[model samples]
Target: MTVRPPQNLSSLSPNAAVDVLAAEIRMEKAISLERTGEAAAKAVAILNALPLDDPERPRLLAETAEAVWGYFIQRELMGQSSHGAVIRDLAIPREVLVRLGVRRMP
Candidate 1:
């Protein structure tokens, strides 16, 4: 069975979203290591070191990353290339974008 990531629902600040994106990168790297039977201790350690106030943040990152990486795996499974792979698949959806919450200049 393929694991899927949950869609982003709650809106957050830009900083929070960046943090989430960073963590997701880390999670994808870790998952790649795991699938190859390589120890992801370093990646896990790094993620654990992050000063994230939201405990759910890490899981969210992992799930999101896995979902993203799954696309690549699917492409390779179909014998595709860099261009053939839908890199745009990684593009963040507009709905998932959080407002910067800054006052606009006139």
Candidate 2:
């Protein structure tokens, strides 16, 4: 197989290349945050709807915790470290909050 030369960015000035790359990065970040938020929401909804006595309730709680944790980490990566507003806005259950980072006891 013939090695192909790198795609040309010489047509773009340094600033222009930087700006284009930045825009792409921003779009990627927005998409990531949106997807994470959606997953967290879905997990929370399933957990909330599960009956407390249901055997699946614990599993749902764990799933919700993982989703919420992922969302939080994504926000933190975006430099939004304050979670009080997010926690309040999402109405995350205290049970799930407590389970964040906790492993199930075998």
TM-score of each: 0.30, 0.84
Report the Cα lDDT for residue 19, model 1.
80
Question: Highest TM-score among the candidates is held by which one?
Answer: 2
lDDT of 1 by residue, 1-106 (tens): 9633335723766577768878987777666644532222233334445566777654644634444345445445544546222333334322212211222244
Candidate 2, superposed: residue stretches over 4 Å from native? 1-8, 103-106
Task: Give per-residue CA lDDT, model 2, range 1-106, as digits (tens).
Answer: 8643235755777777778778989999989999998999889888877788999988889889989999999988998888888777777899999988776666
Largest lDDT belongs to which candidate? 2
Q: Compute the lDDT of residue 67 as modeled in candidate 2.
A: 92
How does model 1 fare in lDDT?
0.44
